[model samples]
Target chain A: MKNLKYLISLIIGHLTVFKHIFKKPVTLEYPEKKIELNDKFRGEHAFDVEKCTACGTCQRVCPSFGTIEIEKEKDENGKFYPKNYSIDLNKCIFCGNCVQYCPFGAIKMTQNYELADEKKSTLKLEINTLKRNYFDNIIDK
Target chain B: MDYLYFLYLELLHKWNLPDYIAMVTFPIIPFCFVAAALIVVVIFLVLAERKILAFFTQRKGPNRVGPWGLFQTIADAIKLLCKENITPEGTDKFLFTLAPLLAFIPVLVVWGIIPFCNEFDIISFSINSLLFVVIAAIPILGILLAGYASNNKYSLIGSVRSVAQAISYELPLIFVLLSIVVLASSMNLKQIVLAQSSIYPFCGYFVFPAFLGFVVFFACGIAELNRCPFDLPEAESELVSGYNTEYSGMKFAFFFLAEYAMMFIMCAFIATLFLGGFLSPLGFYVGEKLIPNEFLANLSVYFEQAFWVFVKTFFLIFCMIWVRATLPRLKSHQLTAFAWKVLLPLSLLNLLIVCLIKAVL
Candidate 1:
């Protein structure tokens, strides 16, 4: 009978729920356990000092003004190295254009994406921190 | 000496209290116990429902609090208590303030007649079955008042839907309960439980012959409580938070508590009516065999009876939660039609069958 099937189906539905009680939950508890990001994830920028030409290509390609600042100051050999290189993460959209357009791959996106900070000034990445991060993450690892 | 009688005398003697004062104080004691126990049970029931629902949906619910989110409801309760009690602008201030209390107080009041065990019974009124029905219906009036007093259109529509759903479901519920009344030959809840103890053709729980009615009663009860699968009144997509739309902070908490408490009360009522109340499901013979020590055995019986009552009640509550997790909310028309067309006729037939069996026997 149709009613009998309905009753059996109801029992089956309940059994399904009962079965799920034993199954492992799929939720990854935030902060304690973060999901692994893919290779393509456009995250924090890392600057390779040895490879960077200080050609100001990154600053020019950046769509958002005031995000990437590159200053050229001549070294003792009269070759230009960046005098003041800064990336304001507050303005950087993480579009990866800076990483993509770099001919020498001087700038790269890192796997570290936990970028939240209490202060606005802290979010801005300086040349020293960027170079340190690049050497520490890319060259050493 | 009867221990109850011994305690009665010793209490009066120790306190130097008069007989009238002792008698007056005796009833208030169980009332306080029931009130305390109900709140504690509601707190756990809310947590259990959320956890079970999460499990059914295959997600971890509320695991951020104390281990496995055990204290999540406590944190929620504290937050509700601390939040600003907001009364929206241009509302009927007096009735709006009164509505949540109206919704809440009746649920605690209904526990006045519900017997946990023979010794723990507060009221033990002869017509407690009828008393429960009357008291349970009173919350709807509060819900309606809440909707009207809020001066909100969504709330008014929700109140109307709630009333419609409640009235339709109430018919089949009362009818099913009436069938049980016919079988038990008394309206007292304690008497109904007692009547189920006699094993005539089999263990004389009316659930066997009145299976149809039991099903009807449960479905109607879900509708009456405005729970999921029958929760059209507060349908999230249709009406924003329903009758309690304008309520906030502790007032909203009252409505929330009352709903969960009512769920507990209904589950306990089902246990009493159809699942043999505080009596062991395996019966006394099994209990005796399981425990041979006379002193411990005697002590265990009282505790065991109360424990079984809680077990049966919680099992029924879990089933209700399971249903909530499994089923989708019914359309408003389907909800009404199912009550009138399917459950109403089935309950009527069930009542007729019960009366015929009662008369023949």
Candidate 2:
């Protein structure tokens, strides 16, 4: 039976060789075919200010010390609202807890998956840039 | 290098009797060429695989080398080649030297019987040449040799795992091969390719109807190659380079090249058998339209032949890479159990089906 096994393997060895000759290769020539990432992809974090209620939920929930800060101001209706809030992108783990606990749906996850930066300050992100500049663009629109 | 080539060429001529005789003696010529091709394919496979994984995992793989990092492999290869070769002092020097060669020989040897041409016009290999199965055993032996010779406890452990996995996986692979042999009714790879040239009605190229064997064959092949999920022998984070732990320099490079080479050969083999070697996907027309002239069409068929082989190999390599990116390496015991418990029974069943179909048809 053992010798029989050797003969059998010898006789049939080419099946693997022949079967592989003419199928569409699984290689996707990239740059030509850019893979699309999903919107809520848990990549590195991007922050939005218009979405941020400035309730400091992001800063408060953050376990990492000195990672986040929120500055408050009076809105047009005299209601206290977030004027300036900054989360150290380096410190922020993208825990999404800030996004989750936001009572106002102001904080959002962006599709910008890439977050590599050379400068140290680049890591210390200000969420205002990611905000929808609705008032700034209202007249332009 | 030129002097060396000259030396090899002189040696080849000295040994040459007829083209057929020369073919057997001069396996190194074709072997070298094939090995080179596999290395290139492996690089391409690595890049494509990383990119695919990045896509699935929601990230971009290396995109900085050339536009979208097409030349990333060249850079990486240069990097590895240039890096320091660190040989551990507390190792068996001779066995350490031999280990990578042991790990690599199987990949080269397996290429011996791949039927690349239909009419068998160009090559001087015999009318009845089938050496691939024999070559397949070389790497298994090589891995075992590497593990023992490395003289590391982890290396010892990995070598044992490799032995166990190779023994268990060998059964299903052979069974799957048996199914194909039954279909073609010939052990010769060229004969098998000739068998596939004429399209059949139901059992088309042993993929459909006999697809169960194809699946099992592919799975076993993956385990045999010691790739992801089955990468117990070289489970990097755990075993610390596994069987070749003490290797360094060109020695390490040889092992690296051989690992990729095995991947390329196994992938190509799987693609050729189940997918249809060098035959146009629809069995015609791609070649016809590419060159309206009949003579050109004949030329295009050769391209089509090479093209299909390339494509199939690339796809299988991609799948291997995909599994690598997605799944963690399998535990040694789990790897054995999967080969025995899941793959073995399924392949046996697949063999039974193929036999029944062959008997009926």
Candidate 3:
């Protein structure tokens, strides 16, 4: 009787696996295909240079050290503006702390997540690249 | 084969060549045909297994090499051919070099023993069924030599487990084969196929009488092939690729070729012993009924017979793949225990039932 049960279970197992052959595959062919990300998905950061007051809040709130850097210079009107801003993607863990803590909402995460690079130095996004990211992704959307 | 021999004789006579030359060259014709067929079939069988297994797991298999991944195995073969041969230090150089060839050559010989169609049994003899069993066991020695020479602990363990598995499984396998021999009443493979022919083709199949034996033989054949669930010899998770661990390049390719080729031949063997070999299950040959020309119809029957053999063999192969996809690898102790405790007794009972059926018939 036990052996009969085992045989029946084996048959059921085969039938279960056999049925899966008709089901659609869940694989996304990388490069040519991409998955739809959620609205709050945190990927590469987009920066609005006009809204940023060179506050350095993003650099302070970042969990990974040296991930965000800002250089500020006072203009003739005595308002601080960023001389240079850069984000080292190697150090940034995509934790969304910078996006969460930014007072001016200048730094936001975009859905452009294909960030692989052959060289580590090339992954550092300068001010121009980050602003372009905001224009290409945020403004266009 | 006789037709080919007569054609050769006519050509030789016209060319003013010796009769002995014709005799010498005639055997090469069949050898070339079998070798070419074996290569093409093994290549396609690899791709089929990959595609089927991919579908079973809900994934797209190799579709990059060519259309529908048709040339994937061909590209792989070329890569293996071009790769550097790596023989590790502290290994026995001679045995390491010879083991893969020793493993591969017997499978080629066994392919010649199978009666594909009525007129195409290249190496048929009265006791060719027995010959198949004897030749099939030699690859185990090659595996043993590979493990002994490799100087690796995992290879040694894998080969030892393989020998143990083969020994335990061989008994039940022989008992199953014995029941088949009883049903067919002949040791010649061609005669076995002829025995399965009747007005009702399905009822004449030995599978009806010795269904238990068929199950046992299928299990034992899987074990013998070192396929999944019984694949202790090269358990990838446990032993890193097993006996051919240190082999690379064309040497490893030889082992790969031998394995898939053995799988095809084993399925073909099962089709012959139980599923009625090259006999059409339709009760009548379609070619004989449809073809208008008498000589063409006679020729088409041979092709139709070969087609039936392939269809049955591939069906069995699909079942084997299904079993692979469903089952987890058995523990080594459970493998031997199942063979001895379960399969042996079942096969004996199957033999008894087959004898009763044969007597009644």
Candidate 4:
């Protein structure tokens, strides 16, 4: 009777495993498929050159200094325009302060968070690269 | 035997090959075939085990290497081959070097008597059952040599555990095998399989009458192979890979290969003795009707037989993997006690029952 009990337990244990052989695996192949992130996910920053008034509010709100840089320069029309704007991604902590504090809505966080780079210098995104990366990830359709 | 001799002569006549050359090369060819089959099967078995374990644990394993990780073992093989062969200081260099070969070669030798398909039998003997028991015992010597030569305390402990495990388990295994031998009334593995053909309705396998013996044999076989639940010999959490702790590169690869190859051999042995060998579970008539080729039917019939053997072996292996995933390792004392207290008496009783039945019928 004890032997029969053990044999039944063994079969039950095996049945539990055999059932799993048919179920779809829970592993999402990361490179081919990305998990959907929530709307409030603070990721890489995007800069809009046309909307920025260059009030430097984003720089002031940033807890980590040297992360957001706004340089002022007079354009051909003689108006003070932001020039050579840069975000040092190494120090940026994906905090929404820059997005929250920006007066003209110039800096907003995009959902593109694959921010790894081989060189530290490459992670320091210039305004153009930031604009491209942010817009590229947006599904227009 | 005479037909096999004539087969060689016929082959030489067809190819116009010299008699002396044929005589010299005839014996070595079987080993070559076994070795090739062993390497190929081990590679696939490793991949299959990883994939099956992954499924059981709700994870994906080795899918990046090839299509569903089919090439993962190949990549691992390449990596192991390229790694530096390191011999630690204060180790017995000669014995350490020889240990993996010692571990590997005997497992290969057991394949000689395994009748894969009907026509693919390499060398069959009347005492094939005894041959299996004897060859299976030889790997412990290699394990002991590996442990002692490594000069590591952990390896030594692991090897000692292995020796103890092997000794304890062999008794139950022998009893189980002896019962089967008595039930079939033959010591020949092929004849034993043949006796099973008409016993049951669908499969006619001995697993029906000798189910207790099958259970004991399988449990002992798992212990003999140093697998999970009985894997105290190579318990990674406790002994750091057990007896093969100091081995690396191709030496470690050899040990790994030998372990999986032994799993295949044991499963095949079980399939042969109790599960109807290479006979289709649906019986020969169904398999023959499916082929329906009067001219090329013989070849197709052998193919079907080989196919059934493959299916049964893999099914048994999958069960083995499932048990590995579900169970935890047994403590050394518990492992030995299970063998001596639980399994020994059970197997002894099974043997007596089988002998009495044999006497009556």
The top-ranked prediction according to lDDT is 3
Interface RMSD, model 3, angstroms: 0.6
lDDT of 3 by residue, A62-98 (tens): 8899999999999899999898999999999999999
TM-scores, all models, native as reference: 0.87, 0.65, 0.94, 0.86
Better of 1 and 3 by TM-score: 3
Query: What is the Cα-based lDDT of residue B111 in candidate 3?
Result: 95
TM-score of the first chain alone, every candidate: 0.81, 0.65, 0.92, 0.74
lDDT of each residue in B1-361, candidate 4, tens digit only: 3445668878998999978887788778767988998999999999999988999988898888878778999999999999999999999999999889989999998887777777666668788888999998888999999999999999999999999999999999999899888878788887887778784454567787778899899999999999998988888988899999998999999999999999999999988888988887775545467657774576577677777877888988987898999887887788988999999998998888887777887
Rank order (by lDDT, best first)? 3, 1, 4, 2
Estimate, for each residue in B22-88, the C-alpha lDDT of model 2 and write its tens digit. Answer: 4454545656666676677778866877776565554666878998889998787887788786657
Q: Where is model 4 more than 4 Å wrong at Cα?
A: A1-11, A49-86, A97-106, A126-141, B1-4, B14-25, B65-68, B199-203, B285-296
For model 2, the superposed segments whose C-alpha errors exceed 4 Å read: A1-141, B1-32, B119-130, B199-203, B288-295
Q: Per-residue alpha-carbon lDDT of model 4 for A73-125, expressed as tens digits?
A: 87788777788789998999888998888777777777877888899999998
* Candidate 1: segments with Cα more than 4 A from true spot: A1-15, A54-88, A95-103, A118-122, B1-6, B14-16, B83-90, B198-204, B285-296, B353-361
lDDT of each: 0.86, 0.68, 0.93, 0.86
lDDT of 1 at B33: 80
Residue pairs whose backbone atoms clash in candidate 3: none
* Weakest ten-residue segment in model 4 chain B by summed lDDT: B282-291
Per-residue alpha-carbon lDDT of candidate 1 for residues A1-141, written as tens digits (9 for 90 to 100):
998898899899889878998899988888889898888888888898777779988888999998998887888987878888899999999899989889889998887888999999989999998988898777776
Between 1 and 2, whose lDDT is larger? 1
Quote the chain B TM-score of every prediction: 0.94, 0.84, 0.98, 0.95
Range of the 10 consecutive residues with the lowest summed lDDT in candidate 2 chain A: A132-141
